[model samples]
Target chain A: MKTLVIISHPNILESSSQQFLIKAIPHHFDVTVHHLENEYPDWNINVAKEQKLLSEHDRIIFQFPFYWYSSPALLKHWQDMVYTEDFAFHARGKALRGKEFGLVLSVGINEAEYQAGGREMFSISELTRPFQATAEKLGMTYLKPFSIFQFGYMTDEQRFQLAIHYQQVLTREKDNSLEAKEKWIMEQLTNMDKASLSTDDKIVLENAVESLKNNRHTIDELKLILEQMW
Target chain B: MKTLVIISHPNILESSSQQFLIKAIPHHFDVTVHHLENEYPDWNINVAKEQKLLSEHDRIIFQFPFYWYSSPALLKHWQDMVYTEDFAFHARGKALRGKEFGLVLSVGINEAEYQAGGREMFSISELTRPFQATAEKLGMTYLKPFSIFQFGYMTDEQRFQLAIHYQQVLTREKDNSLEAKEKWIMEQLTNMDKASLSTDDKIVLENAVESLKNNRHTIDELKLILEQMW
Candidate 1:
C-alpha cells in the first residue's frame, strides 16, 4: 500500500528532526513526502488535488513537530479546508473510509515529563485524542503514533534504528506477532541487492539470514507445542 | 477583574451562536470581545499589540466553534505567532502567570454521544487536554471549559440560561460555592438600573435582591455549623 506523509513546519530548513525523518525514509518505499508550508505559501489549498492525493494513498500520516502540545497551525488549516462534509464525512463522503491515519511527532520535552505528576501531567496518547477523534469520524483506522522525543540527545546509531522502525511503520502491515516479524525480515532479506555486496559483506549477510531462519524454525515449533496444549 | 473574549469563526456574520454570545454579554461587564478574523484579515498579527491586550485582561477566553475537535486554524495561528517564548514563557517571561485561561466551544454533536460505548466514545474534557497542557505550561489557571452542544437543538429559554452560565464563567472568581453564587446574584441585582423599571418590575427586582441576601446568610450559617461539628 502507498503511504503519504504530510509534513508541516514553520521553518523546515533549520529543523534537524524533520530533516532526519525525510532522509531516513527508504528510497524504494512507496511513500510521498508532501511539504505543506513550502507548497502553500498563502494557505490557499487546492481541495481537488488534496482529495485526489488522499484517494491514491491507503495510509496517511501527519508528520510535524509538537507545537503548543499540538501540530503547527498549517496542518490544522489543511484539515479544516480539505476535509469538508461533502467530501470527507457526509452521506456521499466516505472517500476516506477504511484508510489508515497516523501521526509522526517530534517532541522537545523529555519522555519522563509526560505523566500524572510530571511537568506535562498527561501522556502523549491522551493529548492526541483530537486526531484520533477526527480519524474515527472519517471512518479511518487509527494507527499508534510514532514519537521522537529529545532529538538533540540521540546518537547516530540510535537515529539509524529509528529510521528502520519508521520504515516498518510505513510499509508493513499493522501486526506485531513474532511470526509476522520473521516473515517481514525474510522478505527484506529477499529484496536486498546481493549483487552490489562485496565478498565479505555477502558472507556476513548469508550467515545472518541462516541464523534468522533457525530462530524462526525454533519459534514456530514452540508456538505449535503451546497451541496444541491449549 | 477584566475579561477578554477572543472570538474566531470562519464566517461570523452567519453564525447565530456567535451573535447570541456577543449580544448576551452584559453591556456593563468589564469585558472586551475581540474578533480574530476581523482583526487580522491578512494573517499578520502584531505581537506587541496582542501581548498588550493579553496583559490588560485577567481572564482570557478562546471562544469558537469546535472544528475537527479543536479550534479553527486562525486561533492556533494566533497562538503560534503571538505567544512568543520570550514573552509568554521561558526564564523571564511570565506575562500570563496566575491568570485564568478557558475555552467556550460550540459543538455540533449531541452531549450524550461523548462517552464510552457512545458514538463519540470520549468526553469533551478528555478531548481538550491540549488546551489544558498549554495553560499549564504558561503557569495559568485552567478553568473548566464551557461547551454549547447542539446549538440548533437548543430552545430560546435554554439559550438564555446558557448565556447566564457563560457570563458567570467569565466574570466570577473560580469558586463554585453556593454562597459565592448567591453573592454574584446580589451583585448583578445591585448593578441593575432600578430607575428604568416600572413599579411592578421594581418590586420584583427588590424581592429577588432580598431573597438572594437571605440565602447567602443562611448558607454561611449552615457552613459554620458544619465546620464546628466536623
Candidate 2:
C-alpha cells in the first residue's frame, strides 16, 4: 500500500524517538515521510501539493508527539489549510473516500495516566475524537491509533519492539473479516520460515499459527451448522 | 471577575460575529481582549507575557472559531508555548490553579451537525476533552464551553441575544452555592429598574426573581429536612 506518514513535530531533529521510528520504517512499502514543519517553516501550507499527496496515498498516518493532550500546531494548521471544502469534503467527488486514516502519537506521560480516574482523566481514544470525526466527514476508515507513552524512558529493546509494532500497524491490510485476517497471519508465518528466525521466535510463530488454525476451524464449523439449520 | 479573553482567530478583523461579541463585552468587568493573531503575527508566542497575563486573570477564556473540531493552530501554539511546566502545571506555586478555563467557539456548521449521527459524528463536549484534560492537569476548573454555530444564518435579533448571553457568561460570578447566585441575580434585577426598561423586559426580570425565590425556598426546605434526618 502507498502509505503517507505526515510527521508533524516542531523540532523533530531533536527527537530521538521520532528519528528511531523513521529509520525503522520497512523498505518494502511505498512510504512518503512528509515532515510538516520542515516543509512549511513559515506556517504557509501548500494546499495543492498536500491534496495531491493525499490523492496518491491509500493510507495516511499522522505521526506526532502529543503536546498538551493534542498534536503540535502545524498539524492542525495543515488540516485547516489542506482539508478544504473543494479538496477534501465537498469536492467534485469525495477526495479521501475509501482512504484509511491512522494516528501514531508519542506522548510524554505514561499510558497509565490517561485513564478515567487517572491524572490525565481521559483515554487516548477519547482525546483523538477530532481526528476520527475528520476521517468520518471525509468518508475515510478511521483506524485505531498507535500510542507510545513515555518514549524518553523506554529501553532500547522496548523501543525496537514498538517500532516493529508500528510498522506492522501501518502495513496491515484493512480486512474487516476475522477469517481473512487469521488467514493472512497464517500465510505470513508460513512464508517466514525462510527468514533467519531465533528458536523462541519460531516457537511463538508456530503457536500463533496453531491458535489461528483452531479459530478458523471453529468458525468454519459454526458456518456449516448455521447453513444446515437454515 | 477579571476575565482575560484570549481571542485566537487567524483573521478576527474580518469576522462580524467576533467584532459584535468584542463590542458587547461590558465595561464593568476587567476584561482584556487579547487578539492573538494580531499580537503574534509571526507565531513567536511571548511566553513570559502570556504567563503574566494568566497570573493577572481569575478566568482565562479561549475565544476562537472552531477549526477542524477544535481551536485554530495559533491557539494550540499558544498552549504549547505559554502553558509551560514551570508556569501552568509545575511551578513553585501553581499559576493556573484555582483559576477557571473556558472556551467560546464560533463554528461554521449548525449545532445539529456535531451530534452522534450527524456529519461531524461527535458532540462539542466530546471533541473539546483535550482542553478539559489540560484544565484537570493545571488544577483549573473547566467551565462548560459556549458554542455559537452557523453565525452566517443567525438573524440580527439572534446575534444581539448571543452577544448578551456571551457577556453574561463572561461576567457571571464564580459562586459555588445556588443561594449566592440567586442573590446576585436578584440584586442585578433590583438595580435594573432604574434603567429605561421595556414592559416585556420588566416582566421577564420579575418572573425570574419570583422563580428564583421559589427555587431558593425549596432548596432551603430540602437542606432543613436533610439536616433533621441526619
Candidate 3:
C-alpha cells in the first residue's frame, strides 16, 4: 500500500529528532513525504493537490513533534482547508473511506510524565483521542500511534539508534488481517525481551504482535515486557 | 478577578452564534477579549504578549467552534506559542499556576453523535482530554467545558434567547471559594432548567455561573432582572 507521510514541524531543519526520523524512513519504501510548513509557507494550501494526494495513498501518516499535546498550526490548517466537504466528508465518503491514519510523534517530556498521577496527567493514548475520533468519522483505520519521548535528553548514540529504529517501524508492512496482527503483537509482548529492542524495534514487534493467543499471555507478563522496553 | 476571553474562530464575523455572543458581552465588564484571528492575521503569534495576558487573568476562557473534535488552528497555535516553558511551567511553579482554564465550544455535529456507542465514538469530554492535560500540566484548574452541538439548525428565536443567556454565563464573577461556586452552579442549572439550554448556553453557564452565589450578577442578567422591577 502506498503510504503518505505528512511531516509538520515549524522548523524541520532545526529538529534533530524529526529530521533523523525523516532520513531513517526506508529509501526503498513506497512512501511519499510532504512537509506542510515548507510546502505552504504562506499558509495558502493547495487544496486540490492535497486531496489528490490523499486519494492516492492507502495509509496516511502525520509526523510531528508534539507541541502543546497536538500538532503544529499548519497541519491543523491543512485539515481545516484541504479536508473540504466533498473530499473528506459529505456528498460522499468517496475519498478517505477505508484509508488508514497514523501518528508519529516526538515529545520533549519523559514517558513517565504522561500518566494518571504523572506531571502531564494523562497517558499518550488519552491525549490522542481527537485523532482517533477524526479517523472514526472519516471511516479510516486509526492505527496505533508511534511516540518517541524525551527527545531533548537523548544522547547522540540513542538518537542515531532511534532514527534507524523509526525507519524500520515506518517501513514495516502492516498485517491488514486484524487476527494475524493481534496474534503477532501478543507473542512479541509475551515472549520477546523488550529491553533489547529500540523504539522502532518495539513497533515492528507490535505490528506483528496481534496474532498471539490470549491464553498464552497474562497482564503481568505484558507489563513486564513494556517496563523493560521503557 | 480579572478574566480573559480568547476567541479563536477562524472568522467570527461570519458566525452568527459567536457574533451574537460577542455583542452581548458587556462593554464594561472586567474582562479583556482577545480575538485570535484578528491578532494573528498572518498566523504568526505574539507569544510574549499572549503570555502577559494569560498572566494577568485569574481565569482564562478559550471560546471557539469545535473542528475535528478540537479547537481551530489558531487556538492550537496560541497554546503552543503562549504556553511556553519558564512562563507556563518552568520555574518550580509558574504564571499559569492556580489559574482557571475553561473551554466554550460549539460543535457542528449533534449531541447524540458524541456518545460512546454513537456515530462519533467518543463523548465530548473524552475528546477534549488533550486540553485538560494541558491545563493540568500548567497547574491550572480545568473547569468542565461548555459545548453547543448541532449549531447549523438553531432558529433565530432560539439564538436570540441564547444570546441573553450566553452573556450571563461569560461575565459571571468568580468568588474566592470553590465550594460556593459549585453549589451556585447546581442551583443555576436547576433554575435555568439546563436541559432546555443549547450547547453554547451550557458552556457559558458552566464558565460564568459561579458569580451568582456572590450576588455579583453579570450586566446582562442584572438588566433583565431589573427590567422586571421597572
TM-score of each: 0.96, 0.83, 0.74
Best by TM-score: 1
Model 3's DockQ score: 0.58
Candidate 2, lDDT over the whole model? 0.86
What are the per-residue Cα lDDT tens digits for candidate 3 across B128-157? 988888898788888778786665688888
> Which 10-residue window of candidate 1 chain B scores lowest in summed lDDT?
B178-187
Task: For candidate 2, write residues B10-129 as lDDT tens digits.
Answer: 878899879888988755557899999999999998899989988999998999998888889999999998888777776454889999989999998879988888878889999999
lDDT of 3 at B1: 66
List clash counts for every candidate, in order. Answer: 0, 0, 18
Specify the highest-DockQ model's number. Answer: 1
Ten-residue stretch with the least lDDT total in model 2 chain A: A185-194
For every prediction, compared with the true complex, DockQ reads 0.86, 0.71, 0.58
The model with the greatest lDDT is 1
Task: Put down candidate 3 lDDT per residue, A1-230, tens digits, no spaces.
Answer: 78899999988899877767777765556789999988988889999999999999988999988888888877988998887778888766458989888899998888998887888878888888988888877889888888999887889898887875565355545665655445444433665457778999888766555424443456558778999999
How does model 1 do on interface RMSD, in angstroms?
A: 0.7
Reference-based lDDT, residue A177, model 2: 78
| lDDT (tens digit, per residue) of candidate 1 on A1-230 | 89999999989999999998899876777899999999999999998999999999999999999988899999999999999888899798899999999999999999999999999999999999999999999999999999999988999998888887888877778788877777777777777868889999989988988999999889889989999999
Report the lDDT of model 1 for residue A121.
Answer: 93
- Model 3 has an lDDT value of 0.79
Q: How much does each candidate deviate at the interface, measured as C-alpha RMSD after superposition?
A: 0.7, 0.7, 0.9
